[model samples]
Target: MGSLGQHGSKGEIELRWYQGSFYWSRYKLILMNVRFESKSDIRPETLLVELMNFTMKETNYKRLCSTKTVSAVNDNFLGPTILVHKWDTFFANIHDRGKYGITIHWHGIRQLRNPWSDGLEKIMKCPVPSNTSFTQEIIFFIEEGTLWWHAHSDWSCTTIHGAIIILPALRTTYSFPKHYAEETIVPAKCYKGDVMTIIDEALTTGGDPKISDACTINGQPENLYDCSNIWNYISSTS
Candidate 1:
C-alpha cells in the first residue's frame, strides 16, 4: 500500500508500505499565526521634583551636576510589557507617535529565513517616521524562553523596551519542574536630564556626559530614595 501527503508551504511526504492487507494514510498541515502591535507614546519633558533637591558627592559635582537646577524627565511609554504564548505568526505593527524616528528589534527572536522583520534600521529596514507606522513579520523557529523587544533607533531604547515571555505550548511539559508562581523582573536606569541632550553634549564636547541619576526595577525607582517615593508600586492580583 502507498499514500501521499502534501503539507502547505512547509513540506511533503510519501509513504509506501507492503503488508498482507492494503493500508492507507493521510496527513494535513496546520499553520499558526500571531500578531501584536505597539505604539510609541513620547511624553513631553517634565521635572522630577524629588531628584531636584538631592545632590551627588560634592567632589564629582562639577562633572555630573546639571547646570540647570531641575531634573528633566521624558519617558517613552508602552502598555503590557510581558507577552505570553499569544500567537504563532507574530506581526509587530509599530506606530511611532513620538517626535523622533524609531524601530523595534526582537532581541532573542531568530529571524530564521525572514530578514525583513529583524528590525535593524538601515541594515535590514528603515526607521518608522514620527506619526507613521511600520509592520514587520517575525518568523522564527527557535526554543521557547525569555525574549525582549526594544527600540533600535537612538537613545529611545533607553526607555522604549520590554520583556517577552514565550511559554511552552499546550500539553507540553517543562524541562524543569514547574514553579508555584512566576514573575518577570526588568531593571533599568533613569536619568535626570533629557537623554537626547545628554548625547548631544557628549558628542559635541568630547567629554563624559552626566550619568543617570537613578536606577529602577521595572520602571519604578525605590520608594526609599528621595523624590522616588511619589512613584507607587501596585501589585496585580490577577
Candidate 2:
C-alpha cells in the first residue's frame, strides 16, 4: 500500500549532492553526472534481491521512511562489501489505541544470538504503540545463507514482512544463467476504491469501512489501471 504517490505538494522526493570530487591536479575541467534514486516505504524483500544483483555501477542505495532516510553505503574497498549495521529507528504502524505495535522483521540476518535483534516477541519484547518509535542496532550476518523479516507482534503478516540477503565481500561480478533472469518477482497491489476512502468514509459514516474488492500481485502493474480497460490492455500487449 505504501508507494511514492503522484507528485504535487508533498512532491514525494528530495535531491542533494551526496559526494563531490576536486581535480585541481588534472588541470582540466571535467564533470561526472551521476544520479541516484532513493525511495520511501521500501520493502526489504525487493531491496535484498536488487542488492544481490547489482553490478556495482551505483555507489549506494538509500531509502526514506517517516521523514528519515537510511542509506546502505556500498563499499568496494576489497570487493563488494556492504555494512548493514547502524540505524536509529525503523518505521512501522500500530493500531487498537496503542495496544499493539509492529516491528520490521529482518528474516535472514543473524542477530548474533541477541533476542532484541532476533525480531521475536517471545524472544524479546512486545510491540510498541502506534506512531511511537524505537532505536535498535541489528548486525547482518551473511553466513546465514537465507534471511527474511516479519513483525513480532500483532498484525505482523498484514503489514510487516521483508527479506534480506547478504553476500560475501570477495565476490566481484554478478551473473545469471539463461532461465534464471525470469525467476525473480516483486509483489504489488491496488485497492478497488480509493485507499483514503477506507478511513475517510468510515469517519463520515461513523461505522467501519467495508471494502468489497481488492487486487494483489507479485510484481508491478504492467499497465494503467481502469476497470473496463484492464484486460484489454493485457490482451493487446500479448
Candidate 3:
C-alpha cells in the first residue's frame, strides 16, 4: 500500500511476484503517517516516507532483498507496510507512540507452530501499551504471494491497513509465465463522520453503524465526488 497525504499526494511501493520462487532479490522500505483532522469529521490524511539503501533499474532483481524497517503512523494509527520475500526472515520492532494501546496481525502468514508472533491481543500476548515497543520475528516458511497487515483492535483497521508482496528469489523459476507488470489493489471504505462515534452508537443501540460515505481503490475515491476532481484529472492524464 502507498501513502495518502493531506493535499492528496500519493505514494506507492510496488513488488512483483513470480509464480514459484522461495526468495526475493529486491526490497524497499516504506514509512507512512495518516492523520485525521477533526475528531467529529474524521477526514483522514496520509504521508509517506521512503528509506532506501540502494537503487536499481526496473529490469534488475539483484540486491533488492534485505531486512529493513518499515513503519506507518497516524495520530491514531500505527503499523508497518511490508514487502516480504518467500522463505525470508522478517523482524519488526513495533512501537506504539499514540495514546491508546494497539496490536498488529499479519493477515496470511501461517504461524502454524509459533503463535507468539501471531499478534492476537490477549490471545498470544497483551496489547502494546502507549510509548512502548515490541519486537516480532515473522518467518515466511511456506506461504507466498500477497498478504496484508492491520490493527487488530476495535475499528482501527479501517485506515491502518496495507499490502505485503512476496516475490521469488534470484535464479528461481516461476510456476507460470511471468507477467509484464504487476499491481496491488486495496479496496477500502471511509466514513464521512467519526468512525468511533458510529461504533459507539452501534454498541449502545445494538444496531448497524453509519455506512461509509466513500469507497476507494488504492486509497483514492471515485472521480464523481467534489473533492475527487484532482485525482480524476491525474487519472485521466496518466
Candidate 4:
C-alpha cells in the first residue's frame, strides 16, 4: 500500500548532495516529473521520484476496495509528500519511467529565480520523455504551508500527484504551540460516472463536431476534469 524509498521524509535519513549532484546508486522514481527522495535533515538536498506502473488498492465509499494500476511517482499510491524547510533550496530529478512523457509543476510555490523548472510543457520546456530524466532546481523563495504538486503533461497528471509540506526554517517554531499534534489527510471526491455519461451524450449529439474525444474509464468515456489534477493525489501515502 506504501513505498518507502531510500530517502523517505520520515525517520533517520541517508544520501545527500555534494555541491549540486547526488550518488545515483541510491536513487528512485519519476512521474510526469521528478519524485522526491529526501535525505539529511539539513536545509537542502536532491530527491528522486520515479514514475512507473504503480498499482494499489483504493477504497470506494459505495463498494469494496479494488486494485488498480496507473502511472505513479516513486511507486507510491499517492506520490511522496515532499518535506523541506522554509527558505531552503533542494533538487529533484523527475525520472519518467512510465509509458508516456510528463512534466511536474510545483503547484503553488513561488519560483521567482527558477522559472525554467516550472513544468509548463512547451512554455518552459518539453515534457520529460519516458525513460529519461529532468533535473529541477527547486528554490523556495517565499512559501510556508501545505501545497500540492501534479503532472503538467497532458492527461497524465490525472493519475500522478502528491503534496508538499514546508515547515518553518531551522530552529523556527510555528505560529501555534509546539505541543499540538499534527496530521495530514487527503480528501478525495467520490464520483458517479453515469451522470457524466448522460451529459457527454447530449453534447456529442448536439455539437457540430466533438472538438475533443472523451477519455474512457472502464469502457465508458466522460469529460470530467482536464487540469490533470488527479495526479496530485495519486502519490500520497495512505
Every model's TM-score: 0.64, 0.36, 0.63, 0.55
* Candidate 4 segments exceeding 4 Å error: 1-67, 189-238
Q: Would you list the clashing residue pairs of candidate 2?
A: 105-149, 105-150, 107-148, 107-149, 108-147, 108-148
lDDT of 4 by residue, 1-238 (tens): 1122343344333334343334322321111123233333232322222222222112222211223345567655356777887655567777777666778888898776468888888888898887788787675655788887777865455446777888876656788777645555544322233323434666769854223333423112323644333333434422
Better of 1 and 3 by lDDT: 3
C-alpha lDDT of candidate 1 relative to the true structure:
0.51
Candidate 3 lands at a TM-score of 0.63
How do the candidates rank by lDDT, highest first?
4, 3, 1, 2
lDDT score, candidate 2, position 123: 55
lDDT of predicted model 3? 0.53
Give a tens-digit lDDT track for model 2, residues 13-74. Answer: 22212232232211111111111124332222221212221111112211111111111112
> Which lDDT tens digits does candidate 1 get at residues 1-100?
2333333353333223344233222111111221112211111111000111111110111112233221111222322354444223456666665566
The candidate, 2 or 4, that scores higher on lDDT is: 4
lDDT of each: 0.51, 0.33, 0.53, 0.53
- Over the stretch 4-76, how does candidate 3's per-residue lDDT look in tens digits? 2223354333222243222112222221222222433221121112221111001111111222122235322
Point out where model 2 deviates above 4 Å. 1-99, 144-146, 170-215, 218-238
Query: What TM-score quantifies how close candidate 4 is to the native fold?
Result: 0.55
Q: Once model 1 is optimally superposed onto the true structure by TM-score, how far is the C-alpha of residue 31 displaced, in angstroms?
A: 8.3
